[model samples]
Target: MSTPVTASADALHRAATRKAMLRLIPLMCLIYLLSYLDRTNVSIAKSQLAIDLGLSAAAYGFGAGIFFLSYALLEVPSNLAAHRFGPRRWIVRIAITWGALSAAMMFVRGETSFYVMRMLLGAAEAGLFPALMYMITLWFAQEDRSIAVGWVYTAPALALLIGNPVGGALMQLDGSFGLHGWQWMFLAEGVPSILVGVLLWFKLPERPHDARWLSKQEADLLTARAVSSGTGGGHDASRITLAMLKQALLKPFVTLIGAIYFFNQIAFIGLIFFTPAIVQQMHVKTPLLVGALSSAIGVGSVIGVLGVPRIQRWLQRDCLLLGLLTFGLIAGSVLFLLVPTLVVRIALLAILAFFGKGVLTLYWTIAMGRMQGFGAAAGLAFINMLGLIGAFVGPYAYGLAESATGKASSGFFVAILASVLGLVLVPLLPAALRRADAEASQSQRTSARVMTADSPVV
Candidate 1:
């Protein structure tokens, strides 16, 4: 503890890791921002698309929800390919393909074409999120993981923040170059992803060791940290045997977290797809004002992105924070029902957005801490794949509800129930993961125990 050399080395390692984060995270954020924007811009286009293509709310929801089916089907295969061929190459390929498909929405003449294009876009974008998560696992230590993930998680919120207003403006381009405003929005928003994919190709490295920007010492230290299977840390690929992979796929945490994410995603994605329509119903007729109002929800989501960690620190418990966030979802849903005024409803929606998007940081932090290497690739994909069912159900069911009741808010009751179900599973997180205070010391002891158990006779 008193050694100067040891302290210096630790400081250098931290610096290097910070340097890597500075270089990579911005690009990652931009890519994800585009990804989220392209997927959700359809929400803004919903009304116009309905007018142009004669798409019912149910049809629009079905088309939007259908993306997850293809995405879920391909998630594992994409992650596995990333592990084999490198996340850099695979992610770039995915970005390009999806961006092209997203742009092609301009060509969809009817329901069948709309569904086909959405499915193709989903298939193309399948593994990008988990692949990026895996990359984070490889570069950052467990303790640094939350911050890294939190930063990345903000992209979607930022996408909404920026995309909604911009999409609304693009929607105003109603007859520009003889294309519909929705068509213009699709074409305009989709190109950035392809550009960002190209940027990632030259900018990103295959591994920490391969990063030209990192000093050898920094690179080596980061690499060691990544592979260190300390008490709370992740395992190296060396431990990723077939049995271990199978066990990982079957882990209780994976299934449980997947289920939890499934529930939350239903609520979150439902809100994303329908918030504009809801705003339109609020007597906000102007698309720009609607976009601006919708963007306020993004502002709330960003606040949650920033607020979650601060709240986590004060509470000194991840599990408690998780519980509270889920409860926030439930409360937001209840408020959505009780509130009658337009301003109050908008404010409450933001609060709901805060909880909805904020919970993601907690979810991934817990999930990433428990997995690594090939198992992580498979496990993360599996978890996300399962959660995507909720993504599908969120919009589709909301559409059905909207059609049945002629009210968008009628679908929020489902969110209330789903969040409640997720809350019930909160106490089941492993004891060590639940308590922040125990993690460092407990991890050290666990690491020591594993070493002792594995030691050969001297």
Candidate 2:
């Protein structure tokens, strides 16, 4: 009787743990969905906003792209701040502030106001992704992390799929609720994030220690696993100083990875920021339909993010990336140069997007695998910082190239160039890391077997 009761209680606890983790996935996805919606709504808004405000294409492009400037500057510090105060406070604060600023777009009648609001949006959102990444580090083990990260990261793509059409539809409503369609677009998309922010304040567990669903034994096991993995989480004043920053910045591996991400972002951001406009150039009858077609990329991204981790598990990590990069080069070239038919172009764009964004999962996994201690967060921050520089350049360069050539096709060539550059850089990474990863896997399997053999019966 006693043994049966104990087994039942253990099962109940396991179920509860699973339930808690499952709940977090949707909430995190929703949070990121809103974040992307708020960030990229400006792109869709540009359709009506430029005409309404009498702004030039270059000025509009500048305003749309400048959000990353403040975001890049504050990312590391903001991540550290989130680590210090805990996600519950900082994440909620970020959400509320960005949400309100987004809603404030209703009053902007000129380019200056647009630029100011965008910068404010950037400052407000600076900490979000890094903080979320930190949160994932806390909740998940290293082996489980890539898939979890992929799901959270897929939210932006999902938002693009949903938000573009929604924004386009809202923009069609010229004067609803005593505001223009663009104003309504901002209000509708932005206000929900604030509400979700409040909900997150109540819902998010700050750490495993605080998670009611986790048994004391489970929490202790988690902390022990982290320590053994060399990612233990006590606040260390020593790690936050300038010396640590200098060391992280100076590491050759770190710099190489950062450079890789920088070039990768040029292609990624170019596709995302300009896709709708490109689709429009194909002479789609309605802006809303074009927005929906643009969303095909997001659908492809979701498939990529979910699929890459399993691919990495089957193929060696480096080999998987090599294949992805090859696919990217081929698909991107077709999208840019060969396919003249609109339907074929859209299908090929979807294929390119699926593989292109899928590679990011592997990129992040490789970076995290290389780091130790405080270096994990610092390294991720550096890569993102470098990536944002490319993010800033990609859109504006595409716009400028489009204007210069008087053809939208010119932008695709730039994307193709970036994809080819990424393919060239992948081989430069250390081959030994791949071998080391394989050995680590073997050791982990042996340990798991021994642990299973040694556990005592109730």
lDDT for each candidate structure: 0.85, 0.74
RMSD of each: 3.1, 5.4
The total number of steric clashes, by the backbone 3 Å criterion, in model 2 comes to 0
TM-score of every candidate = 0.92, 0.87
Q: Which parts of model 1 are misplaced by more than 4 Å?
A: 229-244, 431-458
Instruction: Give residue 251's error in model 2 in angstroms.
Output: 2.4
Instruction: Pick out the ten consecutive residues of candidate 2 with the lowest summed lDDT.
Output: 230-239
lDDT of 2 by residue, 1-458 (tens): 69997787556545544554686778888888999999888777666776789866566667767787778888877776776677668989999999999898787889898889888898899878767766766665566667777888789878877878998888888776577888988988889999999999988887778877777866765555545554554337444778776765666666766677777777777667778877888887676897788888888788888887778777765544655665575567555577679888888777777777777777666766555446666667777777777777777767777777765556677677776776676676666455555655886799899999999988
- Which candidate leads the pack in lDDT? 1
Instruction: Please state the error at residue 53 of candidate 2 in Å.
Output: 1.7
Residue pairs of candidate 2 with colliding backbone atoms? none
Residue 298, model 1, lDDT: 92
